[model samples]
Every structure is written in structure tokens, then in C-alpha cells.
Target: MLDINHIAKTFNPGTITEKKALVDADLHLQDGDFVTVIGGNGAGKSTMLNAVAGVFPVDRGNIVIDGEDVTDLSEHRRARLLGRVFQDPMTGTAAAMTIEENMALANRRGKHRSPFRWGITQKERSMFRDELARLGLGLENRMQAKVGLLSGGQRQALTLLMATLQKPQLLLLDEHTAALDPKTAAKVLHLTRELIQDHHLTAMMVTHNMKDALQYGNRIIMMHEGRVIVDVEPEMKASLRVENLLEMFEHTSGGKLDNDRMLLS
Candidate 1:
């Protein structure tokens, strides 16, 4: 469902602050594959996700989603093909909008909007209620409440629901649960797995938590210096421990894992 073909990206070219974010990074996902990404700081994990999402044009290579080459497509143009949940709960939803209002916007993603179709219809409200009810957080009862009033975990859960409202071809999760408390993060991660599996969606999740990475996905990939250094398939990943992953990184990258947040987590 997704193919990243030897993509590379550099920021502030020819300048003092120039940095190559992705170097020949390549990954392919089957229609229902859920892959977890792990890396230390500046390992090009988020860079690769942004590149695939077309946040900026890559200097070289192509990004294909569902067999369509979208390397040159603008970020908004790629929205129809991808659903994204960011690290910050505040980033995904409008604070001032009511729960249903925010969902209405998500439901219309990538479609042409008509000024005449301004209000939510009864059928649309019913659908939103059903979707919210699946969160099991009683958000269905708070459909009229402003999103700003929600707790961090609640808002994040709502954002996840909104992202998958239309089932985009690919889902990009960029450390989505990083900001939540451990208990909340665990709940969100569980919901994430259920949502992905239930919809049979293709997904790529960038996470700092090593155990979460290994425990959540069928495949795991590590990155270092803008390249994918290790990709553990299901057979290997099932037998692997966090310590094993650390050893693999040291052996492959010739450097010890230095990210404290990743290790301590």
C-alpha cells in the first residue's frame, strides 16, 4: 500500500545550517502492515514520515502511496491518501470547535466543500455518535462540548478517531502517545492497535518507547544518521528484547544508544 523509493531530503541547502534528514531511505508496506519505527534523536524517523506525507519536496527519489507516485504532490494534495496523528494532542484538533464540529471537518477531508452544506445533518450526527461511542470514553455524550475542555488523553483519542474517519490508504502516527501519562499512553496504544487491526489499515508509527515498538507492531525498523539501519521481521522481532535491539543498534551503527528518553522509557 505504500512504497518509499530511496528518498533523500536536505534542509537549508548550501547554507551553514544545512542538514541531510533522509539518505536513501526506502520502505514498503503491504495493504495491512503495521510497522513501528524507532531511532534516537535526529535519526531521520520523523523526517522520513514528513517526506512520505509531502511536507516538503525531497531532493531525490519517490514516495508512492497505494501505487500512486506522490513525490511531487503538495502536502494538502496527499491528505486524501494519508491520515496523520501528531505527537501533540493540541495539534490535531481545533480547540474552539465542538466535538461533532471537529469530526464534521475530518469527515469531509479531501472533499470539495460546499458553502450551502454548512450544518451537520441528522445522519451525519448519528454516524459521529457511533464512532465516538467506540472510544468508550463517553465522548458520545459530550458531542456538544468544546474540544478545548477535554483532557489530553480524551482529545488525543478523539483525534485518532477523526484521523481514521474515512480510512485513508495509510496512517502516519508520529509519536502520538509520547505526551500522555504512562497509563493513558498504554490505553491509547491499545486503542491504536485495535483501530488499525479492525480497519485492516496500513500504518507507520514513530515511537521512542522500545517496548512499545516491539510489542505493538508486526515489523520494527531502526534508523540512524538518516538511514534505515535495522529492519526486524515478525519472526525475528517476536524473539527480540529491548536489550537485543540495543545490541543490534550498537553492532550495526557502531554507536551506543544515547537517547535517555528512549532508554528510560
Candidate 2:
């Protein structure tokens, strides 16, 4: 349902500070394909997502969603077509808004402006309650509670829920669980798996964790130096061990594995 063709991006072009973030990058996603991406600091994993999101215009390329060409579309235009969750748990939700209030905003997204009531309509309120209840966080009872009062894990969970409220054409998760503790991260990941499968949504998750990368999606793509280096299916990825990934990384990146792997390990 998504197609990226010959995309390229560079920061500070022609200056000493110039960095080519993506070069001839291309990717395609089926209607419900779930893809997990992994790479070190400058592998262009996040750049690919940002490029698709129109955070910054690519120097060249085309972005098509379903069947429409969105290459010239601004970020706001693309926003309605895609849902994104950043690495920072703080980025996705409005802290001051109540749980139901935040959800109300998401629910009404991409609609014509009206003086319609904000917090929750009678029908939507009930649906929100039921959905939040499914998270098992008792958030259904805390509808009026400010999102800021919730923990990081809780907020991320809510972010995940909100992003999917309208079923965007695509979902972009950029290192979504990197900040949480192990247990909390696991919980969020499990919730993520459940939600993605339940909705049969097309998603791309960029992560630093190798094990999680292997265990989650139907496909995995490893990036290095602004391009995709390895794209493997779940069966092939399942046969891969961390050592194999490290070796593959070195071959693709043309350098020794950085200390980040050691630190993460």
C-alpha cells in the first residue's frame, strides 16, 4: 500500500557540514505488512521515516500511498495519511490534556473544523472507554485524568492507541521503546504486537535492539551509511543470531562494530 522510489536526502548540502542521509533509497510495503528496522547511529533508518513523513523534503524521489502520489505534499498533508511515534515518550501526547481529551482530538483528526464539543461525544466516549479498558491500565476509569500524570510506559501505551484511532494509511514507530526499562519496554512491545496484528496495519518500527527486531515483524531491514543493507524475511531472520547480525553489519558498513553494540549487549 506504500511505495518509495529512488528517494535521496542530504543535510547542509555542499557545505563542510554536509551529510548525505539517504541515497537512492527504495522501499515498498503491502497493505498489512509489518516491518522492523535496525541500525546504528547514522544508518539512515530514522531518515527514511522522516523522508516519508515529509519532515524535510527529499532532494529527489517519490512517495506514494495506496495509489496517490504524495511526493510534493507537505508534512501536514502527509500527517493525515500516516501515524508516527517517536523515541521520546514525551513527544506523542499532550501532557495537559485528559486521557479522553487527547483521544477526542485524535478521533476528530482530518475532519472539517467545527465548534463541536471537544472532550468526547456520547457515542465516541463509550468507544474510547472500551478501547482504553482493553489496555488493562484502568485508563477507562481515568478518562478525566491528565495524560501528564501517567507514567512513561502508560503514556507510550496511550500514544500507540491514539495513533491507530483512525487507522492511518501507514504507521511509523521510531525507536518507540528505547527509553523505558526492560519490563516496561516488554509490556509496551507486547501491546504493540497485539494492536498491529489485531488491526492488520502496515507498520515500520525502527529499533536499536537486535533481539526485539528478530522476534517482532514479518520482515527486517538492516541499514548502514544511508541505505538499506540487508532485508530479510522472518524465517531468514529467525535463523540469524546476534553474531551473524554483527558480522553482516560489519560487511555492510565496512567497519568494525561500534561500541554501541557492546554497550547494548
Scored by lDDT, model 1 comes in at 0.92
**RMSD of each predicted structure:** 1.1, 1.7
Q: Candidate 1: how many backbone clashes?
A: 0
Tens-digit per-residue lDDT, 153-197, candidate 2: 999999999998888889999989988888998998998888888
Error of 2 at 161 (Å): 0.3
**How do all models score by TM-score?**
0.98, 0.94
lDDT of 1 by residue, 66-120 (tens): 8899999999899998899999999899999999999999998768885127798
Model 1: residues >4 Å from true position, as ranges? Answer: 115-118
**Which regions of candidate 2 deviate over 4 angstroms?**
115-119, 259-265
Each prediction's Cα lDDT score? 0.92, 0.86
